[model samples]
Target: MRRMQKLAVLGALMLSGAAHAQSSVELYGIIDTGVMYVSNVGGHSNWLADPGTAAPNLFGLRGTEDLGGGLKAVFKLEGMFSLNNGASVNGLFGHETYVGLRDDRWGTLTAGNQIDFMFYSLVVDRWGPAFPFVSSLSLRQGSFAGLNIPNGPPGNGSFDFDRTLGAPIPNSVKYLSPTIAGLQVGAQYSFGGQAGSFGQNSGQSFGVNYHIGTVALNGAYTYVKYPELNHGNDGIRNMGAGASWVVGPAELAALYTNTENTENGARVAVYEADVTWTFSPFVHANLAYQFMKGNETLKNQKAHQETLSVMYSLSKRTSIYSGIALQQASGGPAWISLVPGPASGGSQVTGNIGLLHVF
Candidate 1:
């Protein structure tokens, strides 16, 4: 009886070990909160403050299982939400969700609501260095705020996208190329998912990036011509270019983007610059600005906006910040918006402050 019992215990231990070896999962998140004040607006009022809360408020799970030699299968599921109000960002899954196979030599092939090759390049260029405050928060103010281009034309002359679309993109498959001599390329396809209208609503995008020493450059092109859903189905074309350089204790970057909307012959062009300086291992600051120009002939067009922000880091994942910004509208109604975030809807703003924590 004792021998039989020992055999059973060993078998159970082996099964548990095998399960642990076959899968690995991790949970990660960030809590970003702050306060914002907007002037010359009608919604809420004076000294208005709350958690800048939703900046990077997100949680995610990721795991990988070894398949074989130089190969692995991986998956990630992430969601973004507003901590103050307990509301999720966009889709059912929220931010990003995807699964794919990766090989040392062949690169990675992923499907589901993955990121666009071009968009990823631009976001990285902005976020990698400054770590300004939190992605969802910092970019909403000042010059950096102009980079906020919606997936669809602004309604009533407001530059907001249809976050209800679940994701800016849907039914997507992506391919990433292996890097060669510091150069990498990627492509993506989004299916229209419509009956008898495959070609009518489908879209394609491509991107290329190069890095050498302390300087890196990236460019991307995207074309979408979906005319079936009446959401300006005539389509839109986007092109973006950006460059970054590191020198001594400072990192500098510049970005330019152009979008042409076919349905109405409208165009939006944006220019931005970002600089970061690390005075010490635990102390650093960032400065950024952007300019936006829309079709002046369009009623309620966006005339101009400017923003500036600075922050002091308490640690690698924690910080306190303060910022001041201004916005002016033209043609029609005034369009001085902040972040359109839940706190303020990225509406026009006058001042802001807050704290951020990441884990």
Candidate 2:
């Protein structure tokens, strides 16, 4: 009888210990699609279904396991897909895949494919008032292909040059510091994975953020080496700063970014400002303006763009939105980022209406 009682006590202890260590997993996603009307594309007006205007079509799995002693293990896997034809935008889980350990006092340290500070600081942290409002359509892709960014996507070498669209940095490690007195900092490094060259294709990024009261300030810098450029010695460099203020139901923000291709002496600079206002629990609106300019290597290309957007919430996870943007270019052809093609003229207008659902 004593032996049986000891066995029972051991089993209870095991079960109790198992109960102290807990883990959870969650699946989340967003689906957004709409009809877009472009005034001109390759000299013709067109209408088509577009994705990722209000929000990118993406899904992700996030999990956490308590490790006791104020520590936890966490992981995230995220991917993007096209809603029009149900095709993967990148590879499966190409957007973000990371595993890390978090501690209550030390913040988090993660390793895997990840985004750099450009997106985390400038877009996600500082540009809250302009993000989905100005959307990806207003990001900045012009006729500056003369920059000759080797291996760049077909077109001007400056596609998403500022890296504000969350471009993935593969084989990377990152550290996020715990917020201290309303300030937080982050850094990341990507491995080149070259046989004998450590710097080839390597990249590094750093960001800082501070918030006090209703005002927030952010800044970041990133340098990514491209093996195709200068024998992997030179690459693209980016730096940006932004600030935002909240008052009542309105948010006002401004941002500036500079991008340079060291191999070709190509450079582009952008300035932007925006405002978002909430009229009610279900209604919101935003207005924004942007100016982009390139150096002599790009024929002194310059562009001016303005955007307006409105959203109506049906519930916490569903919303309908509409947006309109106008762009004019001087010294080059006009092209809106995410649009299929460049306009035949120097001016273009685009309007979109879309539905978004989150789960």
Candidate 3:
């Protein structure tokens, strides 16, 4: 009789815990904005407008339900929009919305739009944020900066493609392995979604990362094949490797990327190194240098840039910043645009002043 009573109490406690876990959810997001100025672009100087936010304006929701026995159902819904232009980041396609299952012992598997393994690897390898711009630099420059053009794919008006934000993949399924003694692995695939064509514009990628104490290392590879040749034949191939070290309030990072577009027979390589020094809880400084080569604006051309900036945090969620960047292009004028397109002109300097808020 006593044993039966104890078992009933235990079961009741377990049910209560499960019920509490199932009802928990979290809402989070970051709001960043700023103003930028550029000189010597196109034939005349121009005033470049920036998104009110330093990064893409965004908001997201995350939730989890515990099923007991070290198993859980998890999901995240996130949408990105431009605060300045009031436009969706991905147009009609959702940016990063996914649902998945996670097992404490097994791993996690998710389906929907998400980041690829290569982009994630760049973050793991580099300290602080991926690049000086709003997003990871790897998106603009591949594995090694020199392997491909530093700013973007080698071509006319390539500088327009430079974005300080990370680009998420569409129609993606991703899996992340449980950490095994500080070692982790991740893989993802993006479906082309063409009727009756399984691999028309599909992409597959994978990466591995290892961290010990304050030192970390990572490597990744990605292949995007557009079989139809509508965009290009042989598609685009990107591969990258990076590393980061963190000590006290200072961190250092370096990365290299190679991006090739076989359809047009154009290739660009980029190399980058960055350092951040935190003087106090509210003050920080950043210095970065990037180099690009191969088929720049003109065939067999080259260009390079160095950027530096500093920020002072007023509070945990708000800060003010200022920065200056110097760019010099060879082969032709490398005009800078918000999105990858045609450059207005080249040999320029850019400055920005802004405030950022996070929630």
Candidate topping TM-score: 2
lDDT of 1 by residue, 1-359 (tens): 12322332343334334445765666777776667665544455555554452255778766666778978766666677777788877733546666677788888887665656546666564335654432232332221222233443333232322111123345567788888898888898877666776756667777788888888888877766655325425665677888888898888888787666566666666677777777877666666666656653343245344556666778788877676665554433334333333223334555667777877
Reference-based lDDT, each prediction: 0.58, 0.82, 0.61
- Please tell me which model should have the higher lDDT, number 1 or number 3: 3
Model 3, which residues run further than 4 Å from truth? 1-21, 128-164, 195-197, 227-233, 295-298, 336-345
Model 1: lowest-lDDT 10 consecutive positions: 157-166
For model 3, residues 87-144, the per-residue Cα lDDT tens digits are 7765423446666778999999877666676656765344534233332212242112
Error of 1 at 129 (Å): 2.9
lDDT of 2 by residue, 128-243 (tens): 64455446676777777766565446655767888888887777888999989999999999878778888888889999999998888999999888877887789889999999
Regions of candidate 2 where Cα sits further than 4 Å from its true position: 1-21, 128-134, 149-152
Off by over 4 Å in 1: 1-19, 43-54, 125-127, 131-168, 224-232, 296-302, 332-349
lDDT comparing candidate 3 with the true structure: 0.61
Q: Is candidate 1 or candidate 3 better by TM-score?
A: 3
